[model samples]
Each structure stands twice: as structure tokens, then as C-alpha cells.
Target: MTSTATHLTLNRTGDKQPISGFGLWKVPKESAADTVVNVLKAGYRLLDNAADYGNEKEVGDGIVRAIKEGVVKREEIFVTSKLWNTNHAKEHVRPAFERTLKDLQCDYLDLYLIHFPISLKYVDPAVRYPPEWYYDGKGPNCTLENITIRETWEAMEELVDSGLVKNIGISNFNAALIQDLLKYARIKPAVLQIEHHPYLVQQDLIDYVQKNDIAVTGYSSFGAQSYIELGVDHAIKCPPLVQHDVITAISKKHNVTPAQVLLRWATQRNIAVIPKSNNPERLASNRDVFSFNLSADEIKSISALENGHRFNDPGFFFDIPIYA
Candidate 1:
């Protein structure tokens, strides 16, 4: 599997980043090293990860193995990781970044992201690494840290200046938050990562980011397939994108899998996708998406599937309105 699409430029830094990448979320730590190696061998140039994933060590090991075997060089690949919510304090940011660097066994990351707009209570690094979300017990004992997005973004800019991360971006941020960030950001965010799929197109947000020259990366492109596994009722009720008849017909017309058709839909629109799979066949199929093209009609069909569905809302995890 391969892509004809090359790199997307950052609005602020003009850095070139690979358009398609591999998502490392929900990958079991035990199999993560091998899965990453498989992705690299399959010709994937970008590896998307985060401290919250808890598999950076295995991801690093896989990269090392691939390099040692002459499969790919260090600079040949793009690596991205995020700062977890627990490390949002002005002082805790660098320590968290250092640990990610140490775990990934890399000197510098191609891209680093603020994992979420909200911050959680900080935990001492001496006590735990990638500290749990709640500083106390679950349920009624939960609390949020007194930190601002401005403070976190400021710290992220420092990472770029320190040469620890080449570019900085934001994930799971809404339009209002991004507008506010643009007001005082010394280093503009280069990319915006969010949950996007046929069921949840987010056309307005995509337009806003692109208008600002920030690239968009869509996660959970299969829509309900991912969140349904978590027993999300809304996700469970919606038909899976891969199983939708419109997507199936398009796949049949193009002689590709439903997954490929879905990915091509995003890529054709100039949005990047980070689809994850442990199977070697699926991994290869994902990379092959760029081979086919989706017609304007086909694109419309997919877009029409949108019904304002959203999965993976932080509000579901917290009692308060985290997104608001």
C-alpha cells in the first residue's frame, strides 16, 4: 500500500509532513512493537502516538528494529506524540516531554500535540508516569487541575524553541478554543487532530482549520466501529460506515475495500487520516487508499451520511462539560 500524496505544509513553520499516517491508539502494548514494525515495513512513513497511549516504548523499539534491519532510516519517518492531560502544569510539561522522548528512544519528534484542551490534576513524576486521569479515586472524588490552555500552549511553544519538537499542534480542540488560541499564540498550531468520519463530518470545523492553513487529521474514520466496542449506545445504534451500502458500492466500483474508499474520501478532500489496525492485510490496505479516486458524486454520497453524530466526547467521561 502506498500514497501519491506527499507532504502538507505547516502554516507557521512551513514544515512538510506526510499526509497519511498510522494511529497507535487502542493497540495492546504487547503487540505494539510488532504492529509498528509491520506498518513501517508496509511503507508507512508516519507513526502517530501519544503519552496516553502507553505504548511509546514498544513503538520506539519497533522503529529501532526497522532501522537496524535497513528497512528505513531515522529521518525517513515522521514521529508524533502528545503531552497527556496530567502534565498540564507550566513546569510539568517539559518533564512529560522528556519522558516521551526517552520512551520513544528518539532525539526529536517531528510533531508534538497538546492532547486535549482540558487539564487534569498533576501527579508527581516520582510517583507515576503518564499519571492516571483522576488524582484521586474514581466517581465522586474526581477533580480538575487549575490550569489554562494558554499556559499549556505557551509551554508547547517552548518545546519547539528547545528543539525537542519540530512543530506543535492541538488535538480535540473546538472552533472557539482555536480562535482564542490564535489570539496569543507565539507559534501557530500546524495541525488539528479530531474525531471525524462519514457519520461525523464536522464540515464547519474542517473549513475553519483549512481557512487558517492548519492541516486536519481525522481519527476513527470507520465511525461507529471504534466507539461501539466501548459500548457507546449512540455509536452502537448507528450503522457502521464500512458496512454502509453507499461505501460498499463505491468500493466495488473502484475495486477496493470499504475501508480504502472511506480513507480516500478524506484524502481526496485534503484531510489526513490515522486509521489503526493490527492485521497486516488491513494495514497494507489502508496505505493503498490513495490509488483510487472518489468522484464528486461519490464524495457527496459519503458526506450526506453525516447526521451530526459524535463519538469519543470527553463530556461522557467527566461529570462537567469538558468541551464547553
Candidate 2:
């Protein structure tokens, strides 16, 4: 399926990125590369990944296979990876980035992001790769790194200067935090990736970032599906968006599946979506979202589904409760 996917431009550089793509989170390492190759053949251009995801090497292999088989060129794919919490120390930043670059088999990334606002204590590379999520509470094996967001952002800015990453962005940031970041940022964040879906619309945040020219990308587009797998109590209790009557009705009206309705809802609002799938049917269905138009009434109906529900909060990791 060749795609005519919509794209959003970066704030300072004007780089246009596909509004929808295959998310590489939680993919099994053994099959990730093959899955990526298949997704590319099915028409996705954006490959959203992270170092914490622990599958960069497999993803890199898949990308290489696609190019080798004449499926797509490296320049045609927009690859994104994130710096993990443990790499928050300014000194650890470059080495951490270098590891990811080597794993992804790329000279530079299309976009690199601070995976979260909080920074954990850095563990020696000889000890462990991710160094566990130890920032919220002091553990015997890990301690607070005491690195501030400003220091981290400053280091990330230098990555741009070094041409290691073409664009830089933030993930999981709230409104006030973004405002604070913009105050001292040398280069405005090119994108804001967040957990966005009908259950957690975050419209105001989206509007604010887009107003400032930072494109927003949504993860967990299927509402509680991702969280449910993680055994999150709240997510397990919440109803799945795919089964919601409003979504199903809209899907029926459009002659598409409920999942497609959800993806279309995000894209229709100009927010990029990175929905992960290993199923061939879903891979094709997800990329084919741009073909149809959702009515203004339908879009509004889905927007009304927002309940301020967030499933990926990291407050549990810290003693100071980050999400107040």
C-alpha cells in the first residue's frame, strides 16, 4: 500500500514528517526487524523507536533489509529515537546517543527526544544498559543523578550543533513544563510526543504546542489497550475505545473498522499518530487511514470522549510525585 500520508513541518528547520507511522515499542526483539521491513512495504514512512525499547539493532536490521531489497531509501524513512532517563547526565548524553546511533546503524537520526522530563541516576555502562528506573525513589543499586532539565536540554542542543540529530523534541511534558522549556530553549522543540487518544485528549496542550509551531505526535491511540497489557489497574478497568459505541457507530458509518476511526480521529485533527501493530491486517489498515474524511460532527464527538485519563504517568517511579 503506497501512502499519501500527511506530514507536519518542524518548528525551526521546516522538515516535513509523515503524520502517521509504525511505532516500534514492545515489539519482540526476535521478529522486530522483519516486522519493520513488512511495515515499510505496507507504506509507513515514520519509524518511531526508543533506546529504552531495546530493539534498535533489530529495527536497524529491518531498515537495512528494506533498503537492500529496493523497498525504500534511507532518506525516505523518518526514524526517531529517544534518550533514556539514565542518560540524563550531560556527560553521558553523547555516549548514550552514540550507542543508539551504532545500534540503529545510522549516521544521524531524523528526530531525537528526551524520553521523559525526569532524570535518574546514571549507572556505569559496565553495570547495566538502561540502569533501571530509579529516579523516583533512592534504591540500593541506584541514586539520584541531580541533573536538571536545563542541563539536559543544553546537551541535546549541542547534539543538533554536532549534526548527530536533525531535530530534537520532548515527550510526556505537560503545559507548564513546555512553557518553561520554551523560555530558555536555544532551539524550540520540533515535536511533542505524548500519550494521546480519546481517553486522554489533552486538547489544550496540543493547541498550545501547535500554536508555537511544534508538531504533536500521539502514542497509545487505542486508549487503554497498551496499559491493559502492562497490568495497570486503571487501564484494566477502563472500557476500550475500540468497543465504544460512539467509535463503532462512526466506523460503521464510514465502512471502516473502529480502530481506523480512532486513528483517523487523531490525524483529522493534524496530530501525528504512531500506532504499533505486528498483524499484517492492522498494519495495512493503519496506514490506509488517510483515504477517508471524518465529518466535523464525528471529530467533535470523538473529542468529547476525553476523560483526562492518563495511563503512562511516571509518578510511581519517584518519591516526589512528578505528575501533580
Candidate 3:
């Protein structure tokens, strides 16, 4: 009578929060919603949408409908949204948050993250991709005054105090950048969401976050194979997880999809993953990962897939000099 994945376990965060869900990016902006709450009913407790994704109202609508239908309670969901680049100025943080809250139809969020370590100059939101002094058709300005990373981070801390956000996290930041934040942040960051997949696995970073008790969420677990459709040319055509000799052998041994194996690999290591698939069958299969665990040898074989390459390097963002 076990209805959930037996081996899957939720991790505790600030103030004793437990999360076992994945984030949703690329949710469609159109009318037909599959329901964010039904996703909850399917055991997804995390919805990771952002302003850049342009579907906050629909995401919020889905969640609300699910609640009204008696599918799940608001407290059971670990909702998250990020502050977009254009809003990096200290003065704009709250307004941006309020916009997100309004779109999400929620009073507070479980996690709010600084979308990137970089920043863009302030420009009117009315204009699409406002041309700024840094827009040499090149990249981010990263000027000390254009909106310092610390400035945005400090305000993020304020959100937690004001009870607008429960936990704080950072994405698109490297180890050095992460450590630098530790010097000034009063409320330590609780999670690090990164572009993780078998091919570009980051062990040292993962170990560092784990050593410090900061949770890690893996985005793009299937690798760049998924983003090629989005015009990212360098995205890897990941070795079919179900077909890779290592993954296939193990899946056969365990009677699970290569996906279950991939997820199980992360969950067993205390890493969190947010894999998305709108298809009901795929969603169910993706959620079916918690029943069993990978063997030590299976784990090592999967770990061996890493070769220190990053397919989603945000290099197109190279025109943005901040990371440079």
C-alpha cells in the first residue's frame, strides 16, 4: 500500500522545512493549464518558475485550482521564483518581488533566489530588452554601481526577515563567488541550484555545498539534449540514458528506466533534482523513482560519465562581461 517512492526522502531546510518536489521552468504562457496543483497531486511539491519564464499567473492559477479542488494544501508546496536581471537595483527588489507575489497569488514564497551572480543596468520595464550603456550588443556591464551582487543579496536577506520569503538561494554562481557571499550574508544560503547532468557533473562543488549543509538542486538532469530545441546549438545529445551501457545495464538489473536511475543517483547522494515533462506518462515515470536505490558499482559507473564539460555555459551570455 505504499503510494510514494519508498527510497525517496525529503530534506530539511531553514526552520525545519521538508521538500521532495522539483521545479517547473518553461511552463507555457498560453491559456490551457495542466494545473500546478494537479502536479502537486502527482506528488510534485516544488514549482520553480521565474519572471523570465513569463508564466507566473498560469503557474499561480494551476496551484490555486489544485488547492480549491482539494488536491493539496498551500503549506505542502515549496514554491520558488527568482529576481530577474533587469531588477538587480536595490530599489527594485521589493517591487519585483511584489509583482511575482501578485502573479503567484501567494503572500510568501518558500524560496527566492538571485537568478544570476551578474547584473544589468536599470532601464524601464516597459521597453523590451532595454538598450543600456552596457549593451554594446556585447554582454553584461558588471560595473560596481550597475547593481552590485551584494546589494541584491542584502535585500534578499531582508525578504526573509519581512516574512516574504522563507529561504534564500543562488543560481549560476561558481564556487569562488559562492564563498565570497558567505563573508557578508547574515542568513546563510540554503540551496544551490545548478545545471547538473551526468555529462557535466560537478563533484567538488557538490561536496563543498554538502559539507556546508547547503542543499543542491539539479536542473537539466537530462543534459542539453532538451534545450537543443530552444536554439542552444551546443547542447549535448546525451547518450540515451536508457541505452548507455552503464545506465542500461543497471536499469535492467533494477527493472527501472534510465531516468529513475539518474534521479535515484542524485537522491541517494542527498542532491535534489527538478526534471520537467508535461506528458502525464513521462511525469508519472519520472515520479516513480523513489522505490529502490542504486548499487555502489552502479553509482560509480554513472559517476564515471563526467568529463568536466558544461553544455549550458551561458556563453551566449558571453556578450555580458560580468562573468568575464
By TM-score, the best candidate is 1
Which pairs clash (backbone N, Cα, C closer than 3 Å) in model 1?
A: none
Residue 157 error for model 1, in Å? Answer: 0.6
For each candidate in the order shown, give its overall lDDT on alpha carbons: 0.87, 0.87, 0.71
* Model 1, runs deviating above 4 Å: 1-4
lDDT of 3 by residue, 1-324 (tens): 112232222224434333245556665656315646556778877778777777788888887888888887888777888887767888888888888888888989988888877676555556543232343435454332366778899988888889888888888788888889888988888788887877777888988876777777777777765676766655544454546788778888899887778877776776677777766676777777777878777777888998755655545634443333
Comparing 1 and 2 on lDDT, the stronger one:
2
* Model 1 RMSD, rounded to 1 decimal: 2.3
TM-scores, all models, native as reference: 0.96, 0.95, 0.87
**TM-score for model 2?**
0.95
Report the Cα lDDT for residue 318, model 1: 62
> For every model in order, what is the number of clashing pairs?
0, 3, 6
Q: Which ranking of candidates, highest lDDT first? A: 2, 1, 3
The 10-residue segment of model 2 with minimum total lDDT is 135-144
Candidate 3 residue pairs that clash = 24-48, 138-319, 139-319, 139-320, 140-320, 140-321
Model 1, span 1-324: residue lDDT tens: 123565777786777777778999989999998898899889899899999888889889998999999989989998999999888888989999999999899999989999888788887767766565767534454568789999999999999999989989999999999999999999999999999888889899999999999998889888887788888889889878898999999999999999999988888888888899988899999988667778888898899998988788877756646565
Please report the candidate that would top lDDT against the real structure. Answer: 2
Q: By lDDT, is 1 or 3 better?
A: 1
